[model samples]
Each structure stands twice: as C-alpha cells, then as structure tokens.
Target: MKANGPFKILALLFVTVLAFYLIAYHTIEGRRNRNGPWIVAFTNDLSGAPALRIDHPALAITNVQLVFPDAMLPTNFTAKTILFQRPRPVPFPLPMGECIFMDTTFLPGSVVMRMSGHEVQLIPRVLTINGREQPWKSGETIALTAILTNAISPRLNGR
Candidate 1:
C-alpha cells in the first residue's frame, strides 16, 4: 500500500493549529486569583478619638483579617487589660460603633496600657479591604485616622 503526501501535510497542520489554540486558551483562562489591599479614612470621630462606628443602617465586615504592626501589644496581653464589649449577636451587618464599647476598667486585660507601653505607635494599620488579599495603602502617610473598631475574629478574642 502506498501513503499519500497530502495526508501527512494535513496531519501536521492540524497538530500545529491545535497547539496554538491550546496556548491561547490557557493564557486567557488561567489567570490566577489577584486582589488588592484595603484603605479607608475615618470620616468621623466618637467621644474624642477618631473611630468607625459601623452603626449606620448596619454595616458588616465579612472575612476581616486585621494586620496590625508587629510592635503592637500582643494579643494575649491586650485581652488581659482591655475590656471588649460587642452588641448582642442578632444578625449579619449589626450596628457599627454605638452598640459596642471598650470600658475603661482595665480589669483583667488592658490593651491600652500594653499598647501605650511602647513609646510610639506604628502608622497605617494594614487591614483587609473588602476581604481582599492585599494590604492597605498609606500614601506617604496614614491618610486618615483609622481606629480598628471591630475586629471580628474567632482565633483571637478581645478587640
């Protein structure tokens, strides 16, 4: 039996086209997950310090991972000195600030003294913006006063 030359050429062409198509498809669809950091300004103040209450019509932060500076007081110490209070767990997106309060007792956990123990507080506290995987932006400086009001986490309690 004799083979055909045109058939071989056609076969090679088909392979070449298939390779190119695969490469282009992978490039377009294989983009990995990418997300940017979160940065926001404290538009108002509560009591005396600038804080975000999260009380307006119930604003909820989902998957909030607070990234404080390494120099900030340890989590255990803060729990011991600071008194953390939160609103009754009613539902998602509860009130922001007014419902929660940090009593000045310093009864057992005093995050204030432990935090103030250090001479200086680091600027531009990095927090997850919109549950994204990027750190917040400072832009030359901490653009606004960001009081880490509600850090909803199960691992570390107290504030």
Candidate 2:
C-alpha cells in the first residue's frame, strides 16, 4: 500500500464539513433581505388568513364587500432588530412563508409583509382604526383591502 495518510485525512475533513453544511447549517443567514412590519388587513376567513374573527362570538363574516381606492395598500416596514413588537410575530422573514389573499378574502401563509426576523401575522383581535378612533369588531365583515410594500426598500416592493 502507498500509505496515503494525508489523502485520508483530507477526505475525512471534507466529509465533516459536508455534514455541517447539510445538517447543522439551516440558512440562518444575515438580515440583508429584511424589509417588513407591514400592517395588513384580513377578514375572518381561515382560507385567506390574516383573519380576525376566529376569536369572536361569530365564527364568520357575512356579506363581505371590499374596496381599494388606489388598487393597493402600502406596507409598513420597520427596523430589523431583535426588539420586535406584536402578537404572534413570525419567527422568520418573508419569502420563507407568508399569507396572501385578495382585498376581500383571507389566505394562510401568505406573508403580507416582513421585518427583521418577524412577520405581520393577521389574527382574531380588536383592531383600532387611528383615523376614526374606532375599534374594529372581531367578526365584523367590513370592506377591506391589504397592500404589501417595503417602506424601507422600494425595490423590494416590486412594482
């Protein structure tokens, strides 16, 4: 035999690196793509989540009619820091997973927008309208529209 000690050592090292890359490395990469914190709107339809009627006395909304004056709503993206704010924020960024739905319906895992390491998840809760100082009921089938945008980076907004 030719006593290929160096070759065996190199081969073993390569295998070890491969295992780390394939098993341990879960793509916990940098925050280069973070652009989120979108305040989106959704009804109480689980099919098109971002819903807000799951916790109300009524389990569904009726006679729902949505309208968008500009055919789009803007997304609100915040800083991508560990100091996140919200209820049931997504642990990962967008493109990984999200909720997408039409102006009048709901969709699950369709990420309306994202920030740092969290996402704007729609759930059943009383939402306060700043303009009217009104609190939206949990199961009310109000006409609504949601538009996703990247306030931080317009390029990511995708026109």
Candidate 3:
C-alpha cells in the first residue's frame, strides 16, 4: 500500500496537468458553428454574372472556394489568403459557371452529388442583393461570372 502511494500521487499530478492543457488549448466545435471569424457561400439559383454579394463586405475573407465544371470535372478550387485590409466589393474572383457556399463561419454540410461525388452546402446567416440586405434562406443559388453550357452530360442532369 505504501509503495502505491507515490505512484498514485504522480498519476494525479499528470492528470491535473493534462486537464489544464486541455482547458487552455482545446476548442469546442459543433455543427452549424463558425470555425473562424467569417465564412462565405453562394446558392445554386441565380441568373446573373458571377459576382459575390456579401451582406457585410467588411470582414476580410480568409478562405475562398470556386465550384465549376472544368474539363468535364466538377472542380472545387479553394484558396486561403493572409488577413488583409478588407475593401468593399472585395476583388475576389468568381469564375463564371462556378458557385459559392454561403457558410459564413465555416464550411460544413455537404451535398453528396451522386454524379460528382461532392458538393458544398451553405447556411446563409446574412444575404444581400444590389447592396441591400435581404432575408436569405435554407438554400439558395447564386450564379457566377461564367456560364456553363452543356457542361454536364445529359445523363448527369437526369436526361
């Protein structure tokens, strides 16, 4: 019993230190939770040039994603930028025929596209059109700058 006393004390000390480290450095994350400061997304229902309409154009975008059909591939190109001074109507490229995912905090929720095997989902907390605030919804589609003509095979679009 006496020999086990020191071992128990050391175990307790190690556990205490681990608990402190966990509390200090660990962050809790969950579904529909913002991963960082801001997120941007777009819907799939739009009839305009590829343009991003952010409700508050002040938050510097840390990440950007472009979804488009290139070379018969549903390519999702992503880019991460160092924090910078945000300018209104920020000069981020929105390749036409691509789409944005409107998750304003983090990128979660996905559309398991059977044909492509992957797609993005956005939960828009804020929405804007022509620089005016508007009520967005569960899912919306915003067109990008370029247009996709016969990009998807007829069978893919359910022909």
Candidate 4:
C-alpha cells in the first residue's frame, strides 16, 4: 500500500487540473456566445436628419453613447469648451440625435467619417432596414453622408 500512496496523490492532482481547464473553457465559450456580434450607428444632430435606429437580434446589452467631432479633436477643447463629455468607447445603442461616431474595429477595417472626424468601424453580422435584412460583408463601410445627400438632394431640388 506504500507504493500506491504517491500514485493516488498524483492522479488526484491531474484530475483537479483537468477539471479546472474544462470549466474555464466552458465559461469562456458561454460568454462569447452570449455577447453576440457588435453593431454601431453613427448619427449627426446638426444635420437635421432622422437618426438611424440600429438593432440586432442577439444584442442583449446596450453599450455606450459617444458624441462626435468633439471626441475627435486633439486639443484640450473639452477643458475649454462647456460641454458634458461622456467616456469615449465603442458605442452599441443608437442614442437619438446625439451619436456621431461609433466604432468596433481597431485596425485594417477602419472607416473615417467626414462629419464626425472619427473612424466608424463595425463588425456587422447582419444589418437590416424596415425589418428587411440587408447584405453587409466583412470589412465593408457605409458612408452616411453620401446616403443622406443622395436621398435628400433630389427632394430639395424638386426632382
């Protein structure tokens, strides 16, 4: 029985490590599945245009609200200016008439928005409009200004 003592201790230690690994793996996978895909909606309040409402089927959490142009400025404008600045981070919920820049990616798939002066990035798994699904491929960027101009110019011109 003396020889079996060390063997049993070694086996117990190995089993404990295996169990810990399995638990960690499952926990990470669960969190990733629950988090879902990231979505971003950029809206300009000064433009006098309707804000786009973005929704995802798997988006369970409503993230941050980022204000643009101001967020992109390099100088100490926030200190000189008299505007309440929220923490700049990846925005998820589409705040009405307030959001100007929302981004998700860090590099390679960066998109620059002229009005906001900030890069708008997204990892859109599925984008929809009026409850109809729209096709959005990976690394694709949409220009909000171009869409607005194209859509509104004709109406203003009475064409």
Q: Could you give candidate 3's per-residue lDDT for residues 18-99 as a string of tens digits?
A: 9988876554443224333233433222332222222223333222333333223214633222211122232233322223
Q: Which candidate number has the best TM-score?
A: 4
For each candidate, what TM-score against the reference? 0.22, 0.26, 0.30, 0.32
Worst 10 residues of 4 by lDDT: 76-85
Candidate 2 residue-wise lDDT, 104-145, digit = tens: 112211223332222333332323221222333433553334
Candidate 4 residue 8 Cα shift, in angstroms, is 0.8
| Per-residue lDDT value at 157 in model 1 | 72
Q: Candidate 3, 71: how far from true, in Å?
A: 18
Write the candidate numbers in order of decreasing TM-score: 4, 3, 2, 1
Q: Write down the lDDT of every candidate, Cα atoms only.
A: 0.28, 0.33, 0.35, 0.38
Per-model RMSD to reference: 18.0, 14.9, 14.5, 13.8
Worst lDDT window (10 residues) for model 3? 109-118
Q: Model 1: per-residue lDDT, tens digit, 36-58?
A: 11122222222223222111111
The lDDT-based order of candidates, best leading, equals 4, 3, 2, 1
Candidate 1 stretches with Cα past 4 Å from truth are: 1-3, 32-159
| Per-candidate total of colliding backbone pairs | 14, 13, 16, 0
Write down the TM-score for model 3: 0.30
